[model samples]
Target chain A: MNGNESVAYNLDTEEPGAEELRAGFTALRDRLRQPAGEFVRAKEFLIEKALLVCGMVSILAIALIFVFLFKEGLVALQNASVTDFIYNTSIQYEYDPVADETVAVGESTAYNWQPVGEEPKLSILPLLWGSLSIAFLAAVFSTLIGVAIGIYLSEIARPKIRETVKPALELLVGIPTVVVGFFMLAVIALPLKSFTNWLGLGTIYVDSYNAFIGALGVSLVIIPVIASLVDDALKAVPADLRAASLALGSTRWQMIRRVVLPAGVSGVFAAVVLGFGRALGETMIVLMCAGNAPQMEWNPFLSVRTMTSTIAAEMGAAQQDGIHVQALFLVGALLVTITFTLNVIVEVIVNHYRKKIRL
Target chain B: MSAASRKSLQAVREAVQKGDRAPLWAAIFENIVRGFTIAVVLMLVFILGTIVWEGVPQISWDFLTKAPTDGMREGGIFPAIFGTIFVVLFMILLALPLGIFGAVYMVEYVRNGPMARVIRAAVNNLAGVPSIVFGLFGLGFFILFIGRNLDYYAFGTPRDNAEAQLIEEQLEPLRAQYREEAIAQAKIDELKGKERGDFIRGYVAERMPAQNRKVFGQGAMFWAAATLAILVLPVIIVSTEEALRAVPASMREAAYGLGASKWQVISTVVLPQARSGIMTGAILAVARGAGELAPILFVGVTFFMPSLPLTEPVNFGPLVIQVVNPFQEFMHLNYHIYTMATQHPDPVGTRSIQFGTTLVLIVITFMMNIGAIVLRRRYARS
Candidate 1:
């Protein structure tokens, strides 16, 4: 018989070909099993890679934002020198009837931010001053109260009270910045102005919308942020430090002041810096309550325009591709740089202290 | 020598007695700090109390349902309420998946790699970027760039002349009326020459009907929602990461021991356990999104919109509502409050309405936050 027929005959007769058939069947099964294992491995690899890409989106977004802000803002810098734009303070935009245009009238050939004047001034100094003053005020007020609240929550408050009060304080953070601005404007500003008037400080003239009210509103927003951060920082101080101080015959306040505060000093600093970053970037409170008058005055009762307020107020009406729009973008870029640097610094401090504690 | 030793001993005894007398200075300092802490709490209570007291009077069934009348000095803020809800809902939908996926990747896939550190830094920086900056980004990227591109693709390359003509024709009567009013007012005020002309032009331009015009790369609801989604993304990611981290390690180990794949383990074991925390993160995102006004200022918010963002009732069927084109501008509660409080022609006259709008916004945001807090507590317990 031929080889194939002999094998079939052997299989039917239970001869040597039966062993060959069994070996072939076993080889086929192994081939199938190998691919199954490979499929599972392939899937695992694919999913892991996909998730990694997803995780990288935040990085991608940050990069994209930096690129876009610089690209748009650089257009303004090309039109006006950075030194002129940042250093010049005057915002006088005089209309020249002869030329049928608005022109910058001041003798100084420096940039000023008079977006609506015939000659638009793009100076950023007043905006910077306004932002800094209000943010400074907010930071000062919030830090004092926030640290106290943090201490209270971490050390003084009973456990049940802490649980209730901490979340309730956090709820304050959820209140919209606009609502805070509204509260400042409708509920707080009038009374403040009246009170100032009643005190016979009429010359001080707390404009319904002024730096003080703006700072007040902004402080409300920052308090919860600062409090939460400081609380976490204080909590992070090892319990042993407080216990040791207590064991040495110190009261709770003394223990906190001597041991916990020292240990968590870096964290508290980080909290303040982060709060400052928030205040610097805050827009709506300053927009609605800061009064959109770009001025360099430090008086808290006077109306001042912050960088964020200027951007929000003027961006809507600024002509697309015009110097005005580009200038607003430049302001945004400046904000990004400042806030970003502050964030990095705070992060570094926090990380360093955390590592130190771990060690 | 004996007299000097006795005098020193008497002085030490007086010092000890002073220390035993209640530590008055320490007590005073503690009370002062406590007073400041209580003041912070009082400030919150006072703000909420003021809003409720002033706003409760203005909140009525009709006020809640009707559109603003008399230059936004009176009537209900239905459009603003609807727009706020619509924008927040849209934001949550867009942000949740991206945020959850990002958090999962950070927590599950890349545990402690260099890439993870960089991503974390990026997120932290993003969180620090002000809401106003987000608005500018939205205005520049979403509207000027993306919206323009969309318009060019959807409608041909150039402006549609027919649509422009239709809008101008619709604006014709309104413009004429503004001109007449400006002339009459100018006459009474004895205004002269250029001043009168300027007044008429400004009035007509400011009062022109917005919907009649084609969506020519202006602010719109879709862009606003997109901007808000970006604004709250960091919040969602951080909270979601925290939630995922809270899931016990042993749960994952048990699944792995059963030969379950990594994906299976995460989906079945880890995700189920972390679901409530993720939900809490989502709710917080919504709360934050709902309260935000600055991000949408340049992106899409209108001072007043008579109709809802998505649809309006039309006599087409029993439940007849015509779908609002998504590109149209819309009002928002926070923006409405802003305009009423600050930008209204008669800001002093619109006080009740502003308080009412603020109250509604606070209630909505606080409800979401309280819900999230409750969810977190439940999760903590379990």
Candidate 2:
């Protein structure tokens, strides 16, 4: 309070205000010694490096796949012309004048993908369509069955029954897709063929089985996914909400339909999306059961080939850098694009629902 | 008023009682749908059962230990068993660390930023790619790289093979015009082979004659393992990421609060807790790796070989070679059971073996899955 009194801080000492200087230096040391700062810095650095390396590895793997496909596919692509490839001409009406009954000879087409042509006619449109059709069919059937099972497990069933049934259903997941294919090929395909023939629909082309068998087989694989995800999502809906709904005098079915189902709709959608993705990517069942014929027809009882089947079937013999190989890679790219788009859409929907519906 | 209320309740109960016993039509419909569901489930079980029944009766102790012979009666699955183990072990050796590290980085360290986002996107995309694509990749990338790197051993002189010889013959005329013609011709020849011998020797050295080891068998265990690794990586990464994500945030917070480093938190707290989940994922992955046929058929499954099963204590290769070719009955009890069961040969005699193999495969997968499930449940409860 006097001009003679000088304000002094320990950071700058003339004669050294000993206590103040010691306190300031100690404070500085403590700041440097905070464990939190060191931990954050190290953690951030390691994570950054790890993520970069992982990112590089993933990109490298995916890029390698692309390069290989393109390398092989390019060889196949060069072997055929675009026009012949797309139109896929088959010599159906051959000039057999000697027989007098106009016997048909081999045509430019049989099913959809006849890539093993002398001139190489690669019509993938039918196979793509068949792939989508079969996948869609499987998704629909599985979703319906799975939703019902989900409801029973989460809401309707007794605890004992739920426990018993849940594992049995999940056990289906352990069964290999190839085994499933063989099962359908032997049991479902043959039986369905006979049934169709007996039903006066013998002309329905069930002679060798078809996409329906493949779809059914795929449904078997995906149903478990739907059931599991739907069950989780439904269970995730707080029990209090269900109690509230029932307290409002709603019947069990009414409460489930009005409140629980809506609450878990997004999750159910995710399950279906995942199921669709599975159906789309499934190779073994479709390869075995769909007759491996890429037909563009809407007939479920007709033979069909999918993009996956085509790739699997022809990749073995497709000449290096040939036109056929290129088409196969193109198919891979197409599949990747379709699944990626579907995943994005599902994620968007999921994020949206999570934001919109707090419960 | 109480009487009226009681009467109303009684009326409601009577309606409920009536409703509990569904109308015949409704009952029929319910039964029909349930019947269909049961039928579908039964169909699945029957398929598995049939494969086991058919496949198991044919597998004997001798069949497992002996090398494959002329037909189903003569040979065993010793080679296939060895091949399976060799390929799987090598693949695990290669893929596990890579996939786990990648997953760890993705979940543990990576900030929720663009770089992490890109990595996540790559993983998501990788999971969707077909398994066979990996086979092709393995063929082109791994095989070729290995071959190019080891070309000296692949070719005896590193330049004196049919391809190289042909290239030299073509360049002989060019050598006369230039002083460096002979050297240029040799260089041209070397370029023509393009490490062909190196690649071939790496895979074909075991099978090829030492004097001429130019051509390599396309199918090899390394190729198989690499391809399988690619196929299973996506599954492993996805499951690992999910498992890592499931770890309680408080676990990490507590460790950090105790002045432990981030690595310590992950290694001690996060990893230990997520171990069971990771194991479950790996088990499923191995199951997937074992079941795949399409990729390996082209990449590694041998059509024929005439060497004894590589089962002796000294033969250290990952695959066992069958002294007899496998193509004849490929449907034998142990090896190629899946392939044989469904192939054109549909002989009545081989059905039992098919069933047995199916049973074996199913049992193995089921045991692993059950263990995983039980462990997961215990972890959850704890």
Candidate 3:
């Protein structure tokens, strides 16, 4: 660099040496193209690997859940059979006057989850019905109101009102599940009892913590889910399609019904399916508000225990390596399978919708 | 508007003149939607209103700062509040790193791979798994499997007591049966009394459970925090991913052109911009953790504790340090509300206090949620 400066100074009126400039430029390129230090490379490699592991942690956690559940449950099979998890055949003892012996009178198949006493019946049927019935009722109720609210928000409400209402819905969405359960038990029961009285239903007692209240609580929890999803579904309809429909002299309601809703039908159905799965898995609300009698009945007034509530109620008290804990694991496994399947179905529907809409 | 409005106006007028009801029918549909919307809004308001109406009057300075008294029928919820804070702090510390890294992995590396898709799907499904199922996983995996293994390897034979109990219970019957047979054999063959005793002891010892116990294997705040870290993993990942995506790609390209590495670009250019979004994820995770009761039902939540879940002072010769212990059971706000409202001996007397506790929990979660929403909105606008 000193020799180059002397050469430039000596040049005076003559042109500077191009070779020196080229050499300087080459030096800069040499510095520019080198790898970002060995230490940096090692650090980057290690960090990337660590992050990749972190990324897969969710998958690992899920696999561990499945593995632990099955492994823990397999031991209990020593005391309880697979058939015992489905239905139990109890030998009914009766006094037969003619035979003068109790003899093998009858064998009746029954579903029970009694994991204590002499006969540990671990049948999941009663819980299945309870989960399904409550979830179904919630689905029906939430879909009715939720879909309407979705349409109103997406199409009818003014922008300011929409902005206000959406956040309010979010606040509702953020309300803890247990709070909703408590409200259903302590508060909602009052209005419901009044309504029951207005209907003059004296013989039909409205139990405070029945499957009905559970359904109501679960539905309230899911309405925001269904509404937001349905809102997204409706919003996915292109603006041009909406404008094109309106230009054809259709009313806003007509356009929504005939154009937007039909176009977003797949997404809407996906939302409802997702909501049903959520309702099926809802725990605290059903646990707190449902009477949790674990009965199989058609009457909405009867108390019922869901798969989730049963786990929450029983798991803590279950002794380590016990049959009761293992039974709960089986229930957990069944729940994971159902929800996982529902999620897959929704993903498929959403992917199909995306592809169709892209075209 | 000029042509479409005039045409619609004429259509309405013509329909009215022809005594047609189709236009009115359309309006009726809109009105019905509005009705349902209003009804839903009213329902939500009624719920919130009921809580505020009953809870606000009961909340006081003592209620906020003091522990429960008279069997939780009187006094404040300070311990529950304290426990919730420490738990949330630990949960965020555990969740944020993995969540942020996972989001980075999805957004940067593996963006086009099947692995990312699988993880995305798994996380979404796991997010929907019942809160109680998380409790099960917490019990079975964290408390039973990992915690037991960690304790056995780190804290000595944690399973010894449980093994002893199981051996005692099972071996008694087996030992009795063996003794009866051994005694009969001894009477026939004239065997020694020591030999018969040895036979009974060996038979009992052989039936002992071989596997895994108590320290971390039981419900404690540590396992509760770990359980909640997994529970809110999905929320953190999704939000962080969204935040990462919000960072424009041009910045990364420019950084790369200047010879900056992938992580360098991310740490310097991306994370700074995505900080608010990551904060949003943390806030949401906190809200979910503090408000969630079912996930912690089996994971260390207790009805009440004489003291907080804090550690005893540790001597380091010159300085002693005492910190909140994550292994001990703690009284949590949500669990406190649960036990008092339903299981407390005198629910009637504790009504006001229950409402007060509910209000405090609600306020904490609501504040967290609002902060997340605000951060998200701000990020979106930027």
Q: Residue by residue across A1-359, what tens digits does model 3's lDDT show?
A: 23335335333454577566657755665565567799888999998899999999999988887787777667666677888888989998888889898777789988887877776788988999899999999999999988998999998999998888887788888998888888887877657867877888643565657899999999988998899899999999899999999999987877898999999999999999999999988998998888887778888887899999899888878766667878888888888788878888998999999999999
> Model 1 has how many clashing residue pairs?
8
TM-score of each: 0.83, 0.75, 0.87
Task: Give the C-alpha miss distance for residue B134 in model 3, angstroms.
Answer: 0.9
Best by DockQ: 3
lDDT of each: 0.83, 0.67, 0.84
Q: What are the per-residue Cα lDDT tens digits for candidate 2 across A1-359?
A: 22112323433445657767666766654553465676678876876576557546876788777776666555545665555445666667766778767666766544356666666667767877888988988998888887777766777667876676776776787776667776676556776877787887776556465888889899998887788788888988878989999898766666777899998899899889988987888887888788876667767888878877777667777875456667777676667667768877777876787776674
Residue B332 accuracy (lDDT) in model 1: 88
Please give, as one word, the docking class of candidate 3.
medium
Better of 1 and 3 by lDDT: 3
**DockQ pick, better of 1 and 3:** 3
Q: For model 2, what is the C-alpha lDDT against the true structure?
A: 0.67
Model 1 chain B: ten consecutive residues of lowest lDDT:
B20-29
Best by lDDT: 3
lDDT of 1 by residue, B204-298 (tens): 77776554333647788888888888888898889889988999899998877655778888888988888998899999999999998888988
RMSD values for the candidates in order, in angstroms, are 10.6, 9.9, 7.2
C-alpha positional error of residue A222 in candidate 3 after TM-score superposition, expressed in Å: 0.8
